[model samples]
Target: MSSLEKLTVDKRTLKRIIRELKKWKAPATVLLSLYIPPGRPISDVASLLRTEYSITDNIKLKRTRDAVQRALSSAMDRLSRMQKVPPNGLVLFCGEDMETHDFICLMFSPPEPVPVFFYRTDKWFHTEFLEEMVEHEETFGLVIVERDQATIGLLKGSRIQVLEELEGYVPGKHHKGGQSQRRFDRQIEQFVKGFYKEVAEAMNKHFLPLIEKNALKAIIVGGPGYAKQDFLEEAKEFLDYRIRQKIASELIDVAYQGPAGLRELSIKASDIIAKNKYAELVKAIEEFKRHLVRDDGLAVYGDKMVRQALEMGALKFIILDEDREDAEALAEEAKKYGTEVYFLSDGVPEAEWIKKTFKGLVGVLRFKIA
Candidate 1:
């Protein structure tokens, strides 16, 4: 399948571009944003820009007219070099930096296909379409159930949202007499069944809409001991068939039952979450850790060492905590060497660890620089 159909665009690069473009602005409506979807004829866009350049002469302010014409010229010049639209399409943002008053033009193929053709001139670069590409619209349903308590949550992007919490009462095993003990056991079983049913009802209520929207990717069910197993068994009857079908084949064993259990379930279900952006970030951090533990020359951390490696063209991949003041500068420098760059979000434990231990910047070297 094409990258557009799979929706697999390099999100890290897209985010970096978005962050960079958002900073450029003009005092007047002189900033130009153009989006050309795949299959568009570059010549058509060039002709349109030429017409726009001609129309700029009618502007009341000379400065605004000059800025608008310059931005349009920059865009047209960019399109002239492109033989055709890229697989994912192209985006161009050209304007005057309000602070520096320097002409600025940024162009790239977005990670995802531009859904429509658009062109606009505004004070700020149009980023709404790019923002949509980064939104975590798809979600995973999290259900952690045990005998006494259960928690249902949703893992959308990096955030986990608790949807419902339920509590139940099931008496422990009885030893009073044979008949009395048997009756107590049956009562306990019934209570457990009722709890499972309650959990299922909540799931159906919350997840059915997501399923219908095709936004629910999967459901992960977990808890301590046989309770999880029992739920899966009873799921055939208690859970909606749609939810039951969505349940991941791998059920996790978690010690806690409430919000804590949901967190545990997310970590344990790494195999399932591997496709997620947060999971990918975790994996990258883990890889860096492995190289560090091995004491291999391939691993380097801290600003000084990472910069040295980048200068030598030996850096293969670099991870920078987004909170670091110099992250954008370091990322730009790394890009000069064609190195892969990843910016870790603040507040993530692994990201925080990198910030605290490695001073927020790290790199994996292409070769031993020493």
Candidate 2:
């Protein structure tokens, strides 16, 4: 897959990137971040990488420059192979450990413009950018079921991952008759109960852990007929209290079953999905507005005040317009303070308002910053 196709910048991705950054110490490592704009010539990036590599050679170090040089060459080769850049462009992170002659690349097309920059630090690998990308991610669990079958999985942005599929014995509707038919009807009811119980058990086994970890925004269940609702009634017995509480919606009127039903349900419930993802951000913006109306010290805006709050370790959280040039630096500083950081994209109305009104940065303070 192309870099754009394979790359998904989410919370897990950020965690992995941060872990790598923390472990990558100096003396034997070289880190580089390059901005490859769309339709820009590969020769430009290659030339820049070569110049940086040459500069690294002159610096005093214990390890040989061979690994760094080889890594630069590999990055250049990879760039040359790309016919054109992705829509949002690419940010390439290349690192080489001289001791092991190991080279790694973490390349992706970021949602925001990644400023063209280079850094070779003891413990930095453009993790700030990763944080910015991850702040935009929203993930949730999805369940789709019919009478006899069900599919459970995760929804990561536009991607849908099927985690498990389950099938159970569901008999047809019973017809009216005498005593013999009544006994047969009771047997069918028992079978239906068993089927619902089995489906609920599968969901409990697969989805409960995610709910317990608080990894999902919510669990959205959908299926044809009353099966979705019927399964939830059984799930209450099988699933944990926390897991049961996480069910945001139980949808009926779905046409398909299994994986196909999962995808269809995603489309049908796009609004609810979007609401779950953006609700917190929207509320935060509203709270910031309330502070503004009251002229409270608890909320501050503009790049200067936000940075001041970060320096003082007074920021509870901060929001930045995705288009802001200084967002990456602000995010890095905020991370040090253990402050929550959110990147507001242009599509969001509040984000657009902030972009026009606040010069692209805002912070909710832990206390008055006067």
Candidate 3:
């Protein structure tokens, strides 16, 4: 499957977390902390918080170590009591407080040959971990994040990992303003095509290995000015269906710096999935399938069947065709039971609605899947 094809959050793993987040009393507080042998420096935790997190003053640990200790106590107590943690919110932990033996991190290398990493909060220490992991989208289960220009990984309970890092190679001319230069400025234009050629070569080299690991998803060419465009055209002939349509390949503009390239690539990745719309269809199809096979809070088509499912409390989600005028009656019924309804319109492109119901079909469910 393509990278876009595998972006689903496993419902079985997330159901409990969803349930608890919904049932927990209002004014809910999210707890972020670190678990140590109980003797690690509180400043380690404090500096970790000071660097990136911003909560209310009541949550700060600057002058008062006890404040940090108290928050840790509360979060752990809540974590242990609960069977699961919600994905909708984030909780941070660091230093000794984060060293729980069970902590695990989930890291994706986009290929198997590249090492896969996750965080082990209980076993190790890192300050900015949780923030980085969440950037990968919802495929990961419960965890904290950690990444910077050099590192990217997560801590589910405590899985440590370091993703493969490839620097963006630049020939001398690539850093300058592309190929725009005059004979008087010939020294600056000395390395025009060669610059992008090197970038293109490096990119091809970086992404080609994924096929060996069955992980090649797409090739994106990006850098400012003429460099990316030049590279794109140079690399155009090679975007075979395997990499273009099948692997989600593309060539676009992005910063030449390694870190900036990744951020821009992430945004482009999100756009590729979002603008394409097929990803949503694929997910909706799987969600419906889950409903059919596992009774995981979904019902489909017809008023009687939907209500039967809802009354059985078997349904947590409702899918409706916007074109169905009679939808009003069914919508009212589904809403009465706290069912979440999403419009599946026939007027929209059929490709978009293929996974959802149309022609008066509807889905009813018992819970929400994010």
The top-ranked prediction according to TM-score is 2
Candidate 1: stretches off by over 4 Å: 1-10, 132-138, 141-235, 238-354, 358-370
Lowest summed lDDT across 10 adjacent residues in model 1 is found at 2-11
lDDT per prediction? Answer: 0.81, 0.69, 0.39
Local lDDT at 74 for model 1: 90
lDDT, candidate 2, 1-82, per-residue tens: 7656654353444455667765654465556556565556667767777787677667564354555666577677777767
> What residue pairs are clashing in model 1?
none
Each prediction's RMSD to truth: 12.8, 14.2, 15.7
* Candidate 3 C-alpha lDDT tens digits along 1-370: 6432242233232332233323322122322333222233434443443442333345544423333344444444433432222222223332222223122222111111112222221222233333233222222111111111111221121232323343332234333354553432464333443443443344345444543433333333344555544444554555443433433344445543444445544555556644433454445546776666676544465667766787765665666554454554565566566555554534345425443443446564554432
The candidate, 2 or 3, that scores higher on lDDT is 2
TM-score of each: 0.45, 0.53, 0.36
Ranking by lDDT: 1, 2, 3
